[model samples]
Target: MFMVGRESEAFKHCTPIPILGVACYAFGLHLLKTCGIMRSIARADLDFSYITSRLAVMSQPAEGLVESAYRNHAEDVRALLEGRHKGHYTVYNLSGRRSGALSLHSGDATHMSGGNVVDCPGWKSHRAPPLSALYTLCEVMYDFLEADPKNICIAQCMDGKASSATLVCAFLMFVNMFPRPEDAAQMFAVKRTPPGLQPSEM
Candidate 1:
């Protein structure tokens, strides 16, 4: 588990935190507050994106009751049940991966051993995903959340910084949890990673 961004042992794996109305489990792989962590990532890589205009939220129906569909995807469910997890499995990955990410019904992967990775390469550290990609990614996110409102989704990225946080913020705003993107960003900042703003700016 390569956690990053956050600086708490409670998040040794993932810690559940609410973003507006969505339940998010964030995992920061890098050591907290170390120079290596800071040197490795740019400040923009962990900052929230300010909204320029109202985002065109996606309004679509879920493909299916998809939550936990990947939990038992392996041929050996008994083996899966027997094993305990030190960290939350990367059930969903929001990168541009074509295979071995979603359940057998959703994509081509023999099993869920390799967590579900969405084909969303455009979404990176410094930029938001493209509109086309955003629609697909958020739709998948919404489907899983809607399949069971109790569902807890983990939003993670390569380093667990802005990319993951951005996903949660975008989803929260998509569901109208916040009126503006900035509101969602602010909520995340206060709860997860506080911006490196000076006292005057704060």
Candidate 2:
């Protein structure tokens, strides 16, 4: 009677329970992948050490400060460029004005080399010079992407999270329409924050 009871119990437990368990496991994985919260957590985990090291370098500015800063933060910048992390970043002004001039010249030369110079449309549509500057910057980034989509990731750092969010959204939209979302995601970290929250809230 005990053996008979044990056999019945085993038969009852073996049928739908395993199937339901497998289904539940698959569903949980799907939720995790689709929700993206875990991905963000993983990214933050991977970036924390590098970010802290960078912050430390930023604190010190005595003797070879520029070189030391670059040595410390160069990998972070590269990761950003490679789209492994999300943030707008630039090199610390290493050679001062000379470096700035060189970068400006390089950007200008790249634009001119395209051979399709167009006159700047008047800024009468916008009142502020900063607005005009913003337009110009957008045009430059668009042109750069048009010329070599694979080589560049454009980001701006005004209003911190809002600017980053806008840029990321635009990039994702463009990537979805023209090229590929996975490719764009690989090239730029998408900003993630709950809606209606300011950067300070984070």
Candidate 3:
């Protein structure tokens, strides 16, 4: 799942930015950054070596778990984008490839170009902005999740549980059309704590 929106004349400012928690894989994070869906990323300073070690002990291979996690993460993202979200959070998926190499250009004359590379089939060009509709919802999600209104924090991820919680809070806000950010956070806190948690002990 990719985050996308209509082409804006001015890039959206990173005020209340979306926080992508570390629970997401590097590839997913990288895609958001490359697509310009993210304004700010939350990278908490903490020792995760122990958790990594523990993950290695699981019965299933670590690589498989990682891949499964990434797929689930993408599904969650798609749910947010396609679900009945209020405000500007609601977005439709766009598929198909562009005729030529996709490029991103800034008014300052800075530009970048890239496309799918194939070894035998030759290179392929995809349509520009494969994803759209994430710009506004991202802003609102940030506003709701931020702890301090002054120092706005957009997106965040912590442990698997907490990160899922954060995503659901934002999802609730967007889908239900909560009027106030506080309401969204509060509702999640009281009624939806650790929202959407999968049973791991089983």
Candidate 4:
């Protein structure tokens, strides 16, 4: 599911501006972050860390899921460039990579330069990443958000269920938005889908 979180506050500023959350599935899209003949507060997919093969895809209702992936990836940036989201947005990304992302950004600067995006190589699907690695990810996230409040960070994992969700929760706690990880987890559960965290995630 593609969950777009609004400008979350950090004290008085909108630091950690907007955290865009989505799952991994957009295999056909070759997304490149372009801004104003370009983009703004871009709402494209954050990351795709699948096994980089057909086995990564779901076995049932494959067409619908794939189509949704294609549509979301294609439409989001088009909407932004079309002036639908008029605000100037510097989007960052915080997620993991399995080997590396496939068609998602094989030719884009986001992949090549690692711009505002931070890849957590310790992470895989269904299970959460190492706690130490999570701390590092949160630090990078805080630095990114602190640099500019208007900057939005996008995050994702295989399905935004385990690693992705935990990262969000950890960021919330790390930034003191929530006093505890459990509090952040509760908030994530309320905002996103029901299965916000798997057992391992907790």
| Steric overlap count per candidate | 11, 0, 14, 4
Q: Candidate 4's error at 103, in angstroms?
A: 8.7
As a TM-score, model 1 comes out at 0.43
Our tally of clashes for model 1 stands at: 11
TM-scores of all models? 0.43, 0.31, 0.20, 0.50
Q: Candidate 2's residue-wise lDDT over 37-146, tens digit each?
A: 32332233222211111110011112344644323233433443335322222222211122221132233312433212112222221122234443454445444433
**TM-score of candidate 3 on Cα atoms, chains taken together:** 0.20
Which 10 consecutive positions of candidate 4 have the poorest summed lDDT?
A: 52-61
Candidate 2 TM-score versus the reference: 0.31
Cα lDDT listed for each candidate: 0.37, 0.27, 0.25, 0.38
Tens digit of per-residue lDDT, candidate 3, span 19-123: 343322221222222222221112222111111100100001112346444322333332332332222221111111121111111111011111111111111
List the lowest-lDDT window of 10 residues for candidate 2.
51-60
Cα-based RMSD of the predictions, in order? 14.8, 17.8, 19.4, 12.4
Order the candidates by TM-score, highest first. 4, 1, 2, 3
Ranking by lDDT: 4, 1, 2, 3
lDDT of 4 by residue, 1-202 (tens): 2222333232213122222322211111101112232221344352221211100111011124464654334234324323432232222222343213222323221232222223446566667767787777666554444444233444544454466567666666554444455656655554444445676676
Once all C-alphas are superposed, what RMSD does model 2 give against the true structure? Answer: 17.8
- Candidate 4: residue 54 lDDT (0-100): 9
